[model samples]
Target: MPLPDPSLLFRPLRKLYRRLPLPYALRVLLGRIYRRIGSPVNRAIQQRILANSLFRPPHCHLQESLDSLPDYLFWGVIDWDFRHQRPQHLAEQLSLGGRRVFYISSTLQDDPRAGFALRPLDQTGRLFEVRLFARTAPIIYHIAPDATLACQLRRSIGELLSWANTHQVVSLIQHPFWTPVAGVLPNSRVVYDCMDLHQGFGNNAVELQDLERNLIGAADLTLFASAWLEQHWHQQIPRTPAQQWAVLRNAADFDYFSKPAQHPCQAPDQGPVIGYYGALAHWFDVELLAAIAEAFPHCTILLIGADTARIGARLRHHTNVRLTGEVPYRQLSAYLHAFDVCILPFRIESLTMATNPVKVYEYLSAGKPVVTVDLPELHEFQQQVTIAKDQQAFIDAIARALQAPASSAESRQRQAFAAQQTWQHRVQALLALTEGTQQQPRVSVIVVTYNNLAFTRDCLASLTADPQGQPLEIIVVDNGSSDGSVEFLQQWATSYGQTLILNDSNRGFAAANNQGLALARGEFLALLNNDTQVTAGWARTLRRHLQRNPGLGLIGAVTNNIGNEAKIDIHYQNSQEMAVRARQYTWRHAGLIVPCATLGFFAVMMPRSTYERVGPLDEAFGLGFFEDDDYCRRVEQAGLSCAFAEDVFIHHHLSASFAQMPGKQRQLLFERNKALYEAKWGRPWTPHVAREKP
Candidate 1:
């Protein structure tokens, strides 16, 4: 009669927590915030600091000027957001300018490079109570502007401009969305950073296109992170010698990513380790991950990061895979050590092709041989890593990496390659570009919802609740949903009235997106899915990535249950099989992909202009499936690339609404679509692309 072990009693609870809902995610966040800011332990530390007079607040001070002039930077989404490529990387690099710099941002305490945190204001609002601190250079913060209180911002701006008037504010650098306001800045010079194609977003993309044009016209200089951005803009603008649009290719943190594990490691007991580390989002090739795990039952697939619950439902069966929820940055080394081979199984699209994955650098740093789908972003690392052309090729590459001798030389080569691409270097380039400009940054997000009311509500809620105070608008397109979705959206629109379109009957994915795209007025447009739940800083993550790489055609958020990361077979012969597979795969590959023919209807973001050229998603595909593929094909054909974000992920419950549909109908659609796809691409649809090529 010994007491039951606590571990056994709590195991099921822990699993339940792993599958917590969106509200739970927020509750957890609030709890953490409370603990950090209110808990006795934190209070004690603060008390100690106050007693010792060490509790200094964040500062944004102006210092002595140097020979070189400081620039006016309208930085967007810098410090608070935790993505691979954020504004901090740019700030750190810009600090290298060796000149006095002035920053016009909100809060300003979020970025570490700000080198200061803000303190509470005293009565009479004299700004700081002599708490103004300084960095190596100056990064002034006059809280970011928004629609709520223009008078207060104007006063703050007047003071900030008075200071800028005295000092030589070299240039104004701003994100595309802020173009409309960047023109209002007192400073004469302006620079536009076209990061992503933003208009395709479902709801908030109305102002992006107009904003981008204004920003481009107002800018003395223009720069882009992705090749597609530069090309797209360059084509639009008549050949002007003064136009300085450069493709600031996305770089990796080689130092952190290129090193090898210091200790010998072993995989889990069941099989060889094939793993993916980073955010598991909608753009991930979840299908590939699940298929690979299934194809090789002898392998243990490890996903090291936060649990992606809704998406994980697709991969519950595989006993060979396990999701080790988010680990501390310091502890990541140990997990990478356990992986024999790293994987970059991702959905190919306009968003993914233009991306520069940070994990690529981390994988190389770990000195673990890598296997990934052929993404344009990874084209540079093809020599050092294996680029899989299709599902079979992806599997083959994993096999090759696993079979390779775990030699130190191979490891060293990876580390050496990684050493060259540090976050510091990327930062330096940003500093160089924004040396002299004064432009405010604004962003517009376009989200498209067809009929998924619950999912769309979640997505819209996240945007409205974003911590960043930057000017943002949401353009939502409701494509004739009969599920009372229109009513729900109309209610939301009452509060967030900008642009909301309700179509009569479903107009297909492309046409609905086109409808949204037509109304985009921001400098950038972010296309999102109605069936997905986004994570913290999802918009900022996508924004920063696109900002850093203008050459990108599209960018996407990570999804919890994307492609295929589990081994649970979904080729169900009957409803029973489907249910069993669902249960099994859902448990097995909680954060990995469950095999899919293509990336699902979760999330994708791009600029407004890309749509102008690529047109809209092919309407012929109709409701769903193959539409994204056809769009991706158009992107590739257009020479613009797609990229996947490693930071943000949306929780997507795969084919949930379709679950109740008649099996015959689904089969018919599948066959019809397969035939249509084969007619278009000259190949029958299959789980793997081997049959088509070989």
Candidate 2:
């Protein structure tokens, strides 16, 4: 017998992988491609491609964001425990602007329950800290080999946002991995911060580079810290009409660091103090520091802050060098005052090449004479400070800085420059994005149920438990539910001020939803299924996004058991797991509203105008099989866009109500509806047995 083909043997596995929920299989493919391309040149090309495709400029604005921005949610890259990078400075300033901030740390906590640890980020009592404690897929956990962690974090954050009663979350996130969560956050205005280049990612160059492109595509605004980074992204990433972004160089915290220090006078053995404070590692340029220490044996060279590697060890034994193992932030000013001159001796590698050093302005704030390496980020800082091209040039620049007057006209210019480069200004520039944006509330939910009382109960329970109490009118059209659902709904309507449409018999999905449509008063109308459980604040979230882009005619959230791109397996084993997964999914794709052709009525939200224009679901497709498609086609003809809100997740029990009917009858109706739908829309509406993702 001939040997069987290998393609047949592996085809089943490939098919199984492909069947995995929306984006999961795609992410897996990206991960595999990333692993295969080990060469740096190929990796750079891949990185460029990812940044181009993955990232996006801002697409939506918040209420009064142009006039006066509200509270913020920061998908921060740096933790306070790590470097006090741009996010920290901007968040504090934004809080000072009378807005609360929830800074999400990049470090994932080990405990799942610890995912949402709330703590005070600053003494102001306004800025809060929330951590994303995502479970890692050990062997497969290669940064974002897939959106596993992104999905996990996004879901949890969504729940947290609902529970906190925080809507209209304007966020600034750096990592492309966390961009999905930014997409899913309620009424979010996401700005993707390009602080560093892929080459600067060091060990994570490939993975982070891969994710950067998607982050660009997902963000409503893309911000580049350096012109170098902006130019590179422009060269690599293709522009979209929806992509809106700009460049803003990193600034310094002048007010906090500018005031002259009161304590810690010059060191007892100081010849001329040359101090460097920041992380000490590969970027520290140990050889240069050693060269400086050797050249100036009489001068005291101070190295402050923590060390990640053995680079600090080598500097410790130098006679002229003093390594002060990390000092409190409060004492940093004093330490700066103690230094006669400040120096940034960095390795001229890809990492340093792209860095807009946070210390440059800090040094200027102290009015200290500074010397640094030749960096593209420092091109604007010329004439005030010396830029060294090599070790010899570095030594000469430091000598020049030391020789120059500490408070000359050049020094005054430096201080003036630093004063203008404050965090307050950076934040204002950031918020300027929301200029002339209109905000409005819009959403009416219409749920249809047959006999699935259990799922209906859970759905109402979730809807009723909304923390924000955002104004939403719930209308339930009982399609002749016999399992006490109508009774429960009657009581629910009486208690909760919901609109109930009573029918004596099954009116089918189209007629029932049409019945609810007649009663809906909000700007947007949602058609939901009784057999599906809505996550907390599902209506509110859907409404926020519908308001996000007014051009959208209809929007549907992803579901646990929905078909095609909307399907996501949240690994539901229990109610807690369900909640966890739902929240994660919500936060992960919070801002990602993709233009779609078809939206299932199982849980779909559409504008009131769309319904008025396209009219209700066609009752022609009886028993509700392809009415949604026919309606969607009409919407298309009306020149309105349909979209999928990937950030929202609903738990669907998989045709629970439909499964109860006779198989032949259900099949017959489905065929009849398919025929009616195809006849009406000039396209086949058959079961998607061999279909491709749209």
Candidate 3:
């Protein structure tokens, strides 16, 4: 019948393929090939098939399961079953601390029936392993996601959140693959957990490096696995706030590793066992291990973990060396009990230099003597670990470690030190940093007045108290107001103890605002038109967004009357109605933000750091026709975003000062500023239009 449908024929083939017991390695290779050759429709069909396999309970059921608990979704770098490392440890600790965690794995199941599975990882049901089934999985491990794949992943994540009715989320990103998807989650905070020098992998280095820079710039808190990584990136991206980054080194599960092995290793009859565990990747020092095997001819050298670099042939000839492939995490302690000395033999490279090995901490927890190459991170643990500079020194250190007794002072001291550096402690510090428990950030409000006495008084009165109880520093600039505005401001300043700047002549809007900006002392700065009256919690809401979204440099408030996209239709006729309308709108669109190319400066806020980087607004814009647009363009150029908070509504008596100017003069000012902006940027300006209501 018109050539049998291709999908119908392939359906049987797909079923047959799923029934076949294919090797995992082969499946992974096939998945990679499919990613390269599969059509968008085929990939989408595969994702849908996977999604259908999961047992998705009712929304209310999922909601009740995680009632009143905070959520942390980890965009994981490795699978939960893969080597239990930093990502697993952190997720486990957070879940234990009364937060529900969903760890999305990089590894994808190949079987069609294996769909997107959400497996509970702990008995408490707080920890989950989210297994995504898609052919694009292998592609993301080394490179960033393409647009199509990012859209697909975002939809999948949105679905998962909807099932749980998650309102607030903290996305803990462990790899650069998730960089493009950062800050897209609703009411979410983003954290970049930098565990490795990703560019050192040498597979798509340029793309990886670029993505990392963007991730660091956008993350609310970027955690470095080592102090060296923190300092290195700090120097690289100096524009980012110093407080935005912190060093959170890898730690071990002390109780798990410290417990004596239930079954001891069956040693080779005569000699001691010198062991090393973890991934045998490119950075692994195979040459050093070979040398150690040759030097310790009498000893048995055991290597555990997957051999990803195919270095087994090089070590096979060493009769005394043994390679025990990947072992389960629970069984690792048994091997650790048999070792006379544990070693970290890594080459001196950019990657290794930045590594803060998790195995070192685990080794110490088991009270084992440790020997490692001269990695910078080990210098702090030199007393607990032996640092060897070369192959000869490594062998010598191993010999010394073997000679030390099991219950020696150094062994006991190593255990004692590791006890204090548990994963629980690291998670506690991380929670404190992400929870915004530090001192409240100060806000400086600048109201540029030009004879709008009533509006100015209302704006000033609204600032008397802050909803968040943060210290407020109000700075009022009277730009040659002749309606007794300067006298009123002087008396108001005297009464409120606020700063005042008086101009003898009518300075342009940009100039007057710049004068106020220069005297601003708060960590956050806001430019408010004297014609607008702010609502309660307006400043706090804007500051909260800035704190939660590091990528957003400048944010403006939605108002009832504005010329740009920020203007939303309203039905309020008086101040009382206005307050009620604002409250209703805010509740309906809580935490909603609309990213825009330009944000009006009628009521805009930005951090002090952003102001410092973008500098003051262009004075050439004169009376502020295109000054906001120019500043927004500069912010975008500096790799930041501009958006308006849909939840924060202010009352604007539109253009109170500009309306007083004669029509001809106002038109002349707009034309001149438009020409200046076009000439400076070599692009035609796009005139602002009101946003269409949905």
Top-scoring candidate (lDDT):
3
Stretches off by above 4 angstroms in model 2 are 1-70, 112-115, 123-125, 136-142, 145-151, 315-317, 434-694
List runs of model 3 lying over 4 Å from the truth. Answer: 1-70, 107-117, 131-138, 146-170, 183-190, 239-242, 268-271, 436-442, 445-694
lDDT of 1 by residue, 80-121 (tens): 234325443444345454543344443322111112333222
Better of 2 and 3 by lDDT: 3
**lDDT per prediction?**
0.57, 0.72, 0.80
Off by over 4 Å in 1: 1-74, 78-81, 96-174, 187-189, 200-204, 235-239, 260-271, 305-309, 325-334, 408-410, 427-694
Where does the lowest 10-residue lDDT sum fall in candidate 2?
54-63
Better of 1 and 3 by TM-score: 3
* Candidate number with the higher lDDT (1 or 2): 2
Give all TM-scores, in the order shown: 0.46, 0.61, 0.66
Q: Tell me the TM-score of model 2.
A: 0.61
Task: State the lDDT of candidate 3 residue by residue for 128-194, as single tens digits.
Answer: 8876544456556566777655555654565565555453567889888877654455445678998
